[model samples]
Target chain A: MEYIFHITILISIYGILALAQNLVMGSAGLLTIAGAAFYGIGAYTAAILATAFGFNIFTTLIIAPIVAGLIALGIGISFARFRDDYFLLATLGFLMIFNTVVRNWENVTGGSFGIAGIPKPHIFSLTFDTPFSFLVLALIVLFIVIGICYFISRSSFGRVLNAIREDEDALKIFGYKTSTYKLMVFVIGAMLSSLGGVLLASYITFIDANLFTVNESILLWAMIILGGIAKNRGALLGALLLITIPEALRFFGFPNEIAGLMRQCIYGLLLVFLMLYRPKGILGQYKL
Target chain B: MKNILETKELIKSFGGVHAVDHLSVNIQEGQITGLVGPNGSGKTTLINLLSGFSLHDGGSVFFGGAERKKITPWENQIYNITRTFQQIKLFDQMSVLDNILVIITERNPFLALFERHSKYHISQAEDILKQVDLFEKRFHNAGELSYGQKKLLEIGRVLAMDTKIILFDEPFAGLFPEIIKKIENIIKALKQEGKTIVLVEHNMNIIRNLCDHLIVMDAGKLLAEGHPEKVLTERVVLEAYLGE
Candidate 1:
């Protein structure tokens, strides 16, 4: 039961990240590999603030996304200069830069040894110290994030984004500053990814630079691709499917060492197959 | 009538060859002006330059009264100048209603974040779609529309923009005769509404019937400009079209 609860918490967390990725990749038509980087930033910011300054865990949760957002705003401004495929490459470069900082900045990130003994989440009289309780906390945050995403996708802003994804020149001819729209969504995506990071740091009660690697970023992308893009409901569905597939793999009784490798292999193969055969994803209306 | 648009020595070039060289013209308000030229005669290039899709090497373009410098397509919005592409450029992923609704939405980012399509905007979109005879396909994806319908949708987008000066780069090319007639009616109606129109067309019959004034170009320079009835019969205009 505890193990089942543990998996549920992970889905809730990954579901948030998938929604963030969907905002840019699905809605805005930008394929970026920066999810894991922003996730790491959120975790590290919260971890440092909590351990060093003794800030409340819930307070850091609020601050984590904002800190990551401010950073993304700066990075996203520069990113606006790159278009289409070049933008994807630039994001990959940014992911590497963030990874390197976390690995080498030992004074803050603890340099791969990772920051351990982090406390679980607590909200005033409530404590999310147990797996079941943590799942509840994560779910509350998830619903809030989902609601926000739904509003964004349905609003007039979303229509413009859809227009942009189709024909930027046509949208611009009508007088929309496409770059500003792109930047706003990119930063918003960063903020949402950071929300997932905060939950993950608190849930695991540990932190590490290695947790946020290119492979993790690809995994998030694979989730959105498998589930669908442009819709938060698709994001949630994808996170659920991806989170269970690995655990389902564990049940296959594969060799201990090969099990982890096999799951990654399956993820990689699925991404390629889906991209070639079903670029729109299972529930998506638009192709990446 | 005052000129709503003016180009002073507007110049553009591709590689070493000039596409538009020392080309100057004035477009009067409330007039349907035709821009007719042979292939590679720089008619489309002139529209691109005026609409801020291409940068001129050495020249100035004046819209209304202010000089526009180093403008991009989106910036042309402020000058109330809009255009359609020779190649159709509609949002294929969006519904016909959304194609117009997006333009109808407020340009202010904060306001648009929460803004829904008001009944007024929807009715306006419906009216414009009706003008293009596309009200029934308002919910259809633009990509799925027929080629002629797609052209009408593009024109519908321009209507949604509600700009003062519209530069059309062959809006009639590749469309059916009926669709062309509908567009002709729309253009004529827009003229009645006091909009300035610059049309680039290859159809001489439509040019003769629709254009109030005609401007002819050959190898990047103005060949003729006068009343269509008079300009269409010029010996140079005949040679420019027939290559005598």
Candidate 2:
């Protein structure tokens, strides 16, 4: 029962990551690699606040995503002018810078040893101490986030984002500010990624820079890409399948090292194949 | 009547090669002014400067008695000046209806997301679509349309803007005869509604039929400007075309 609970939590966390990545890659047509950086910021903020500052888990949850969002806003303004490959490079640079900050910030972040012993979330008398109880909590948050994402995707602003992806100049002629919309999506994506980080930190009761490394960022992308992009359900499905693949491989007699490498290889191959054969993905309505 | 748009000594150069060299013209309100030039002539460049698509190195654009120092594309929308690209610029992935509807709202950062377009806006879009005879294909994606239909849809989008001035940059290029007639009627209707229009075209018959006045440019310089009949007969105008 605890194992099922943990798997469910894993799915919801990754589902958030996948959806956030989709906002940049799919919705806004930006190829960003800074998801893990924001994720790390989220984890650190929540961890430090909850542990050293003696703040409530709920307060840290609110504070963490906001910090991540502000960080995204700063970098996004500088990089938003860049289109296509340049934007990708800018985001990758941000990701590297963020990872370096986490690795080198020994005093605050606890260095490579990481921060642990994070208390479980509490709502008055109710405490999420066990994996099962936390799973239920994560699932509820996941539903609310997914609903907001859905509302955003179907909204008029969502249509404009999709339109800008198709032809940005067209949006401009109609008096739309394309850059403003792009920046909004970038920051929102960062907030979502950071929220995913907070969940992960609370679930494992640990925070480490290694967990939010570039590899994990790419893994997040893989999950979003595999599930298909631009569609909410596809993002959810992609996260579940990609997250489960490695564990399922372990059960089939593959060693951990080979399993990890193969998962990445399959993900790379799938991304390339999808770009060539079906750029739209399974549930995506628009083709880039 | 006072000129709605005027370019003073407008100059644009590409790598030291002048595309529109010291050329000037006035776009009057409620008139269909036709611009004719041979291939490589500065017709499109002139339109680009006027519409704020490209910057002019040395020039002043006056609209509503106010001189604009620099014309940015976004400013064009605010001033109600819209243009159809030489190549159609409709959102190819959007449905034909959305191509027109996307522009009808306040494109504010947050409002763009949640603001539902007014019913009147949709009705206006439908009317514009009907004017272009594309009402039936409103639900179809723009990329799926024929080339000429794409041209019509772009014009329809501009129509939906309710702009006072409209510029058609070679809108009839490669269009079928029937499509051309439909576009002609639409332009004629716009003219009847007292809106200003500037058209760039290569077809002499269409220009002669539709243009109220004719202006000619050759190698970035104004060759002649007058009534179409008189301008076409000018020795300088004929020489510019023949020389090219």
Candidate 3:
């Protein structure tokens, strides 16, 4: 029962991250691997504030997104000069730089050792000490993110993003400096992903550099692409599938020695099979 | 009475061949100017340079009769100088109404964050769609439109920009004659409203019938310039097209 709640919480947290990923890749037509970096930024920012400055989870929840947003703004503005693959490369650069900071900044981030014993979230007299309570909190955040994504997908700003995705040059000639829009939305996606990061550290009660890396970024991309792109419901379905399928394999109770390896092989195979058969995934509209 | 746009010795080249060599021309405000030339004579190149899609190797484009400055393609969105491509470019993923509505967006990106298209914007879109005969298909995805419909939608997008100077690059090339007639009326209406248009076309009939002034080019140099009827009759133009 507790295990099911834990999986539900994981889905809710990652569901938000996948939605953030969808905003950049699915709507804005940007393929990036930098989401993990901002996610880490949010986690570490929360971790540092909680342990060092004695800030509570709620305070860090609000502050961490802003911190991550600021970092993305600086990086996004500088990298906005690059387009297509170069922009993708720049996102990779940001990922590496962020990972290095978390790993080497031993005093602040605890370096490779990581910050552990992250305090679970609490508001007023209510405490999210159990998996079920935290799942409720996580669901609230997920719904908020969903509402915002729904609003964005229907708004005029969303249409502009759709335009940016389909025909950037046409949008530019019509008097919109597309690079500026790209930067703005990149920052917004980063901020939203950071919220997921905040939910992550508090729920897992542990933090580390290894948890946020380029590999994890790729995993998030796979989630969105597998479920779908541009659609918020796709984000939910993606997070559910990617989170539960591996845990379901564990229910088989395979040998501990080969279990991890076998799980990885099956997971990789599933992605390949999905790509071959349902290239658009279950709900994806975009191929990439 | 004053020239709205003047190019002084504008030069562009590809590898070693000059595409537009020391070319100079002036366009009066509130009139339709026809730019005609044989293939590769640089009509499209001039449009590119003026609209900031491509940079010229040398010379300057003096607009509003003064202030010679370098034109940056990305930053020229505010210049109200816009163009349509030789090949029609529209936001194919958006609805035809959205294709027009996106440009009519609030200049303020902040306000546009949550703003749905207001009644004013919708009505404006409707007006342009009706003008281009795409009102019936406003909700359809632009990519699903027929080729002729795509051209009309592209022109509608240009109209939505409300730009002072519109560069139409071969807008009528692949259009059906019936659609061409519609575009002809639209152009005539634009001219009547005093919007300056530089039409790059290969159709001599369009040039002769619609253009108030005409400039002809050959091998990256001006071959003739005057009223359309007089310029089309030039022996040099006939030879430029037919070859000596």
Candidate 4:
């Protein structure tokens, strides 16, 4: 039961990340790969604040996303002119820069060793210290993220975002400042992904630079692609399946030494088959 | 008739070649003005300049009798000027209704995030779809429409903007005669509603049947301008543009 709760907590955290990413990648047609960078920013922010200043989880939660959002605003403005592959490349560069900073900034980020002794979330008398309780907190955050994605997907703002994906120049001709919309969604997605980071840091009660690498960003992308892009349920479904699949591989009795390698092989093969047969994803309405 | 849009010595160039060279033209209010020229004659470039899709290299544009220094496509729409592309450009992935809704919905991003499409907005979009005879395909993706239907949807989008001056670049190109007739009626209706129109086309029959005023160009310069019948009969226009 504890193990099940652990898996569920991880799924919920990733579910938040995937939904936020869908706003940029699916709705706006921006192929950003810097999700993990924002996630790291949030995690590091929460870790440092809670440890150094003895701030509570509630305070860190609010501050972390704001920190990530401000950074995203700067990046979005600087990279506003890039489109398609260039945008993707720019985001990948940002991810590398972030990774370098966290790994090398010894005093603040603790270099490669990273911060430790992070506290679990608590609200006055209540504490989310156990796996089940943490799972409950993660689920609540995931639901809030889901609600935001759903609201944006149904509004007029979402209509413009869909139009931006389809044809940005056409939308501009109709009097939309496409750049502003792009920047807004980028910041919003960053802030939400940061929320996921905060939860991960607090739940693990430890922090390390290795946890928020570019590979983790790629995993988030795979979740959205495998589950479906643009659909909220698809994002959640993706988070659920991708998290469970590797764990399920553990039960197959593969050699412990080759288990990690075999998991990678299976993941690669599944994605290949998905791309070949279901290019739009399992429930996707739009193709990248 | 008053000039709704006037360009004074407008110039746009690409590398060494001039696409619109010191071109000056007038668009009369509440009239259909045809821009007829051969290929490479800068008709579309001129439309691009007027609609703020491209910037001028030199000279000034006057809208509502006020000289404008700078403009963007969105700013132009806010100034009550809009356009349709020669190639149909709709939100292909969106529903036909959404193509219109996007234009008619809130312009404010914050308000738009929380506000659902009001009854008036949906009804307005429905009216536009009905106008273009695409009401049956309201829920269909814009990309799934036939070429003629796409053209009509583009026009429907223009109508949804509710702008005063509209520039159309080869709207009748690659369209069937029946679709052409539908577009002609829509343009005529727009004119009747007091909208100023500038049309670019290669079809002489369309120019003769629909245009109240005409401007002819050759090599980025105005060759002739006046009543359609008068300009079409000019010896220079016939020899240079009509191949007579």
Candidate 5:
């Protein structure tokens, strides 16, 4: 039962991350690779506040997203001039810098040793201590993120984003400040990803630099691509599939020695097949 | 008639060559001004300059009798100046109606987040689609539209802007005759609404039929200007542009 809850909680967490990433990469057509960096910023913010400053989970939740959003604003403004591959490179560079900071900022982040013993979330007398309780919390946050993504997808602002993705210059000729729209969406995605980080930190009661690396960011991208781009249900479906597949592989009774490698091989093959047959994923409306 | 748009000694250069070199021109209000020139004769360059797609290296552009310092597409749109591209740019991923709605939708990003397209906006988009004869395909994706339909959608988007001055760059180059006639009617209707229009094209027949006043260019300078019939017969315009 605990194991099932654990898997469900992970799905919920990754579902939020996928939805956030979809808004930037799928909806807005920004090829960003720094999702893990923002996620890590949230984790570290919560971890440091809980461990060093003695702040609670709720406080960290609010502050962490704000911090990540501010950083995203700076990045969006500075990188506004870059397009296509250049934008991708700029975001990748930020991810590298963020990784370095978390690994070397010994005083605040605990460097490579990491921080642990994060208190589970609580409001008043209710504490999300057990896996079941935390699963409930994660599900609630996931639903909220889903609702936000849905609202954005239905609004006039969403239409503008679609226009931007298709032809930003043409949107500009229609009097849209394309740079401003890009910046706004970038900040919104970063802030939501930070919320996912907050949940991960408190749920596990520990966080380290390894949890938020370029590989992790790429995994988020893979989840979105496999499920569907620009589709909220696709994002959730992607997170669920990617999270459950490895665990399902365990039941196949492969030798423990080669199990991890075999799982990787199967994962790569699955993605390759999906790309070959369904270039837009299972339910994608747009192709990058 | 008052000049709705005027350029004074305008200069735009690429490396050592001037695309629009020290060229001065006037676009009169409520008049269809045709810009005709040979290839590499600064017609499109002048449109780019006027529409704020490209910046000038020297001289000034005066709109509504005010000397503009700097220009950007959105800023010009706010000043009631809009344009269409030669390549027929549209929001390909959006639906046909959405391509028009995106123009008429709210500009405030925050307010737009909560605001659904009002009934007025939907009706407005529908009217534009009806005008362009794409009303039946309103729900189809813009990218799925045929080339001629895409051109119509592009024009429909510009109409949604409801601007005072509209600059069209080669709007009829690849269009079918019926589509060209449709666009000709649209331009004539826009002039009837008291809008200023600057059309850049190579079709002499269309130019002679649609243009109220014609300005001819050669090598980035004004080669001739007058009624299309009189200017078409000018020896310099004939030799430099008409290839007579």
Candidate 6:
């Protein structure tokens, strides 16, 4: 039961990351890499608020998304001026900058060692310290996030984002401010990513700059690309499958070093082949 | 009549080559003005500058008698100024009905998140589709439409904007005669509604029939301007088109 709960919590956390990545890359058509930055920001925000200010975990959870959202909004505004590969490059720069800031800001973020002793959320006298209890919290948050994403996907705003992907020029002539819409999605996606970070920190009771590294950002993108770029089912499926791959391989009894190497090779092959053959991803609406 | 849009020495260049060089023009309200030029004559470049696609290097553009510089394509829609692309720009993945409905529906981001296409928005979309004779293909994906149909869908998309000034950049290109007639009627209806229409078309027959005033451009400069008959007959215009 504890093991099952652990898997559930991990899936829910990464599932949110994948969904947020989908909104920017899939919906808004902005190929950005600043996602991990926001995620880390949320984790650190929650950690600092809970530890230093002695705030309630629930309040920290709520405040963390807002802090991450402001950072995303600022970066999105500057990045909106660029397009194509340039925009992607700008976001990559932002991710690196965020990581560096988190690392060097030892006083606030606890530096490279990261903030530890993040207390679990409590309901009256009940503490959600165990994996089983955390799983319940994670699953509830997952449903709420998924519900919100599902609603947005079917809404008129979703159509605009899709339309932007189809033809931004067309959306503009149709009296839509495509850039503003893109920025909004960027911030929202960032907030969602950070919410995942908040849960991740709470679940593990620790977080560091390494947790939100650029490699993790790429991993989130890979999950979205593999699952299906634009579809909701795709995000969830991608998160589950990608997260379980290494564990599933563990049954072979290979050494950790060889397993890690094989995992990297598999990820590389999947990404390359997916791009070359199935650009639309497993469940994408549009073909690559 | 007061000029609705006027350009004062508007200039734009591409890699040191002047595209719209010292171009000064005025578009009066409620008139269909034709902008004609051979390839690279800066007809589209002028449109780009006016629509805020390309920034002007110098000069000012006054819309409704206010000086505004470097407007965004989306913000220009709020000023009741909208344009169609030379390449038909429709949401290809979306149905033709959605292509039009996305325009007329609430553009607010928050509202967009909560609201699906309301029945009223769909009805309005269908009305525009019917006007363009595309009601039968309303459910078809816009990309599946033929070149002519795509052009018409783009026109339908713009019509939903209900703008005061509509710029058609090469609207007649790649269109069949029947589609051309359909568009001509749509432009006519827009004109009848007292909307300012600026057309950059090569088809002289349509220009002669539809354009109340015409401006000829050649080599990024204004060649001539007047009624289509007068401007088409100008020796300089003839020379610009059919050079010795």
Best candidate, DockQ: 1
Off by over 4 Å in 4: none
lDDT of 5 by residue, A1-288 (tens): 999999999999999999999998888989999899998988898988888888988888899989999999999999999998899999999999998988899888888999989889888899999999999999998999999999998998888888888998878877888888889999999999999999999999999999998877777887888888878888888889988987787788877668867656655776687778876677787777
**Model 1 steric clash pairs:** none
Query: How much is B86 displaced in model 4, in angstroms?
Result: 1.0
True contacts kept of 3: 0.64
Per-residue lDDT of candidate 6, residues B182-209 (tens digit):
8999999999999999999999999999
For model 2, how does the per-residue alpha-carbon lDDT over B1-244 read when each residue is reduced to its tens digit?
A: 6689888898999997899988888888899999999888899898888777788999788887689998877777777798889977778877898888877666776876676667887798898888888999999999999999999998888888889999899999998899999899989999999899999999989989999888899889988998888888888887877452
How many clashes (backbone N, Cα, C below 3 Å) per candidate?
0, 2, 1, 0, 0, 0
Per residue, candidate 3 scores C-alpha lDDT tens digits across A1-288 of 998898899999899999998898888988799989988988888888887887888899899889988988999888877877898998999899889988999998999999998888887888899999999999999898898888888888888888889888777777676787788889889999999998899888789999998877877877877787777788789889888877777769876667767656655776788789876678865555
Clash pairs, candidate 6, are: none
Runs with alpha carbons beyond 4 Å of true place in candidate 6: none
User: Candidate 1, B174: how far from true, in Å?
Assistant: 1.2
lDDT by residue for model 4 (B90-170), tens: 888789999999999877677778878989999999999999999999999999999999999999988999899999999
Error of model 1, residue A50, in angstroms: 1.3
What's the i-RMS of each model? Answer: 1.1, 1.7, 2.1, 1.0, 1.0, 1.5
Residue pair clashes in candidate 5? none
DockQ of each: 0.79, 0.64, 0.59, 0.78, 0.79, 0.65
Model 3 residue A107 CA deviation (Å) reads 2.1
Better of 2 and 3 by DockQ: 2
TM-score of chain B of each: 0.96, 0.95, 0.94, 0.98, 0.98, 0.97
The whole-model C-alpha lDDT of candidate 4 against the native structure comes to 0.90
The 10-residue segment with the lowest total lDDT in model 2 chain A:
A279-288
Residue pairs of candidate 4 with colliding backbone atoms: none
lDDT of all predictions, in order shown? 0.88, 0.84, 0.85, 0.90, 0.89, 0.86
